[model samples]
Target: MLVIFPACSVFRFQVSQGKIIDPPWRPSIAGMIRRTKATVVPVYFEGMNTLLFGILGILKPRLRMFLLPREIIHQTGKTFKLKIEQPISYENLFEQKLQSDVEIINYLRQRTYHLAHRI
Candidate 1:
């Protein structure tokens, strides 16, 4: 399935300011996973946000690519890294019903936060 960012979520950041903000994770995702019995794979990308290029992207709103200008995006003078955690089973998530959608979202956000902090 394609990854789509719902409104008021990650893409709304002003400047890739090296901060981790947890926007609401739509419950619909959980619902869909439950319906389809799919595993939720959390993939984290580090350094995907470069301040200047990220600001440009925020301003432009149309030129949407993981990286805007190849040069400036990496101009932060930092290298990038990617982390992929083990797929989270929907069955397991459903079994653990105590965690709400917001909690699940925050958990995922924390995963990303830890991943970002590496760099």
Candidate 2:
């Protein structure tokens, strides 16, 4: 099974001024990884937040919020970039000497953001 975890607990719209937020990632994902020995693939989407904000800008905020799902489904002619890094082996994760599950998750979170910056 594939499990997707966001680096932050909060949504992008919760922040003001379109600032990039780096709230602490939930550590439960790391625990799950350790228990299941799941290989992790760090993935980052660069333009998704911008697209959402741009849509909000064009339409009334409240109405847009309600229509966001439909807008995303029906809208066309927009491009976004995504980067999927090489998978991290379950053994490799322990070999890193991260000290704790939280640290392992933090390491993965850093790699994901690094991908975002590079893209």
Backbone clash tally (model 1)? 0
Q: Candidate 1: which pairs clash? A: none
Model 1: lowest-lDDT 10 consecutive positions: 4-13
Tell me the tens digit of each residue's lDDT in model 1 across 2-115. Answer: 564432334445456665344566766655655687777776755545565556666775553544456454556576667777777877666766366666555655655566
- Per model, state how many residue pairs clash: 0, 0
Candidate 1 ranges beyond 4 A from true positions: 1-23, 57-79, 117-119
| Candidate 2 lDDT by residue in tens digits, 12-74 | 443455664545787888998999998999988655544655456445445545655665665
**Any runs in candidate 2 off by more than 4 Å, and if so which?**
8-18, 50-71, 74-77
lDDT score, residue 69, model 2? 65
The per-prediction CA RMSD against the true structure, in angstroms, equals 5.3, 4.3
**Per-prediction TM-score:** 0.54, 0.69
| Clash pairs, model 2 backbone | none
